[model samples]
Target chain A: MRKNNLKGWLYLLPAMLFLGAFMVYPLIDVFVYSFEEGYNFASQTYFDIGFYNFSYVLHDTYFLQALKNTFLMVVITVPVSTGIALLISVGLSAVKPLRNLFQTIYFLPYVTNTLAVGLVFMILFKKTAYSDGLVNLLIHWFGGASVDFIEGPYWAKMFVMCFYIIWVVMPFKILLLTSAIASVDRNYYNAARVDGTSAFRIFRKITLPMISPTIFYLVITGFIGAFKEYSDAVALFGTDLNAAGMNTIVGYVYDMLYGDSGGYPSYASAAAIILFVIVLTITCINLLISRKLTRGFS
Target chain B: MNTSSQTNYEQISKTSARQKRAVHVLVYTGLALWAVMVLFPFYWMLLTSVKSYSAYNGERFPRFYTLSPTLQNYADAFTTVPLGRYLLNTLIFTAATTALMMLVIILAAFAFARLKFKGRNAVFTLFLSLMMIPNELVVITNFATITNLSLRNTFTGLILPSVTSVFYIYLLKENFAQVPDTLYYAAKVDGTSDLKYLFKVMAPICKPTLVTIGILKIIECWNAYVWPRLITDDENYYLVSNGIQEIRENGFGRENIPAMMAAVVVISVPLLALFLLFRDKIMTGVSRSGTKG
Candidate 1:
């Protein structure tokens, strides 16, 4: 047993060292840095230490904007995208012909580069001197005024952001849910039909309950994913996200560290800690809700 | 009375069949519409990439189909910016990171899954808990550490922090544990080394899971943006993700939309091809991770 223990640790050594340097140490360092007041990056010095960094980050307008944007994104995108994906998955479960073709089409966005997709979306939505863009042209055809989805009003930009997020994320949810629905026992549905149960009621009572666990799983993961949405915003609005009024919490940390308003390590660490807290609190709440919901279904 | 009841049964069956047909049509229509919404962007991308710069700019309203197709933008994508270099850099990063991560995770998973060790479960639990710390927190200090080490703009810096994934290690451990212990014992009794047993027996048994992890890791490294963007400001070190962004901002400029789209198409095609070829493996990997989480 002693010899085996030594051998086991030898196997784990490389991974342990890498994780110690990159993951564990950074976590501790970030936590400590968050409390250091007005730390200088170049000098590697700080005069004082307290919650002052936290206070500054919490009060900063850019951080506030980032917080608001992240919250709205979380609130809007999570439920809307999951619902849309569920509908599509359920529809997909019922279809027979060309199902594989449709599934393949839906999954395309999952593998494509986010920035590349963002550029395509930018071209599709941005109104330029030469054209009104395809989306605005469509609006014009429908007798609605052209709305500049990119570089436009707050609501319009938010709409575009949420729409883009939904489009990108729905494929995975659809894949998972479609399989979840397919795995459900066929006997229950047949019994329900024999008793003359309506399709809607059958869905509500049987199908929903059977797949409730997967639904709850999607919601929890969706919330977490949306909270950490920096790249998507960067892809859409460029790296100067604060100026675009669409910066996420993660983006705020990056900006503080390495943007036009850069070189504020203390402030960045504090903002990162705040993001960590928010995500943790929400995850806890989601876990609680899912526990109750799943138990109720069972 | 029997005849009347039979006729009634026939009438009911006919109505139900018609209703089922209606539902099928509705489902297909809905799926088709959503599919279009899902696919239209790719269509638009391919369309815009082929249109001439002059033709693209001259349009008063965007045309869904281009009358004259040109490969000029693709040529421009390569020449105007070193997109070929970005692709090469991305390939190097993805291959190095995935290969190194696979080796590290496999060894660690073998330890946890098969080896008898003091504090093994406790250590595995600790590793699992590390996943709870969001990547954002870790990334901040990693940036500082990489900079302090003066390893910026090098492949070593780009590949180091990404070479160990706790989630993948956990996944592989579960898979490794599923192999029957008899084979392991038989090999051990024959005086085969642990390393040899791992390569010869354990790995081949878990080949599908291994492939899935490799494919997923490649996709991740290819799509990685934030860390690469932070670490490498030098154009020579940029991955396709950030390289394309650089092209958009500086190389191509915003005015050259067709050229920009062409750049994007070049970057997106490789992974698209990979996914198409290994569709089942990727889907199973994704769905497995989703449910297990």
Candidate 2:
């Protein structure tokens, strides 16, 4: 028994070491660094300012904008993408022909690098004052004034970001919800059909209730993902978050840590911890709210 | 009475057929619209990449298709910067990260799944909770740690922090637990060491999940953008993601949209092809991960 314990520990040693040094240590370091004010990276030293760092971050206008942007992304993208994905998956489940092909097609964005796809979107939405770009071309056809999506005002940039997120996230949710829908028994549909129920009623009353678990899953995971939105910002708006005034929570942290010619690790670390707390709190609330829904079926 | 019932049945069947046809139209229309939305960007990428500089900047609104096409942008993309080298670095980083990540995950997952050691549940729960902590939270200190170790601008710096994913460990643990405990004991009774049995028995049984993890990890590493950008400052260490972003940053000032699109096209094609080829594995793996989580 002792020998077995020793062997098991030995097997876990490498991974444990890696996690300890990287994850656990950094986690603690970030917490500590969050409290250190004016911790000059060059000098490798700092004085602890108690809760002042947190207060500073809380009062900072840019940080508040980032927090609001983060919330905006989560609030808008989650429901929009999840609802669209649910619709798409339902439509997909109804069609028998070329279903796999369609699923694969839908999944293209999920596999493609976000930065690459975001770049593609950047090109699609690039400034075309003459309505030359693809999006602008569409805008022109509708007699809508051309707006420079990437370089436009804050709302335009956020609009572009939300659209990009929906495009990227819709695929995975579609895939997930499709399988969840597929797992529902076909007999329920047959019963509903025999009762002369309308198709819309069948979907709302039967199909949706059956797939609520998956819907809940998507919402929870979607919120988590939206909270961590990063690379797309970098890809869409370039590295200058201040120029765009569209800094996301993670993007704000990232720019703080890396954007400056000199480092602002302390502020960045504090912002990161704040972001982490917000995510954790929201996720816990999600779990709590979803408990009643998920508990119904399973 | 029989004639009336038959007439009613025929009427019902005919209406049902019409309804079915309507449903088909709805399904196809919705699917087609979404397919167009999904594919439009790629089409846009290709279209923009092939447009000639004169046409791109000429006194005409850009349309979907170009009457004349040129490969000049692709040529310029290769020539303008070290895109080729960046792609190579990305490939190296992805492969190394995947392999090393898999090794770490398999070991840790197996230990968590089958071993009856002390603190097993506690340790497993700890790892599971670790997944809740967003990676961005830790990246700052990780950057400091990497810089401290003088691993900056190296593949190690990029790979080390991300080597062991808590999520993958949880996934493979779930997969590993599904293997019958009897087999593990049977192997043990037959004098197989735990490591030997892990490789010979558990790993083989979990091949599909392993492949799933491997594929997902590859895609993760491939799509990784932020960390690699943070760690590497040298042109030599740039991955395809940050490299393309950097190219876009530098390119557009010269009105090099075509070249940037060409670079985007080149970087995107391989994954698109991979998805086409391994559609089932990728889909199954992804859905499996989702459901299991």
The estimated TM-scores of all candidates read: 0.97, 0.94
Cα displacement (Å) at residue B112, model 1: 0.6
> What's the C-alpha lDDT at position B198 in model 1?
100
Give the top-scoring candidate (TM-score): 1
Docking class of 2: medium
For model 2, residues A219-294, the per-residue Cα lDDT tens digits are 9889888988877777888888766787888888888888662388888988888887887898889988889766
Docking class of 1: medium
Report per-candidate DockQ.
0.64, 0.59
Scanning candidate 1 chain B in windows of ten residues, the lowest lDDT window is B4-13
* Cα lDDT for residue B54, candidate 2: 72
TM-score, structure 1 vs. true = 0.97
Tens digits of lDDT, candidate 1, A151-230? 88988888889989998898889999999999999979766765667889989999999999889889988998998888
Q: How much of the real interface does each model capture, measured as fnat?
A: 0.82, 0.75
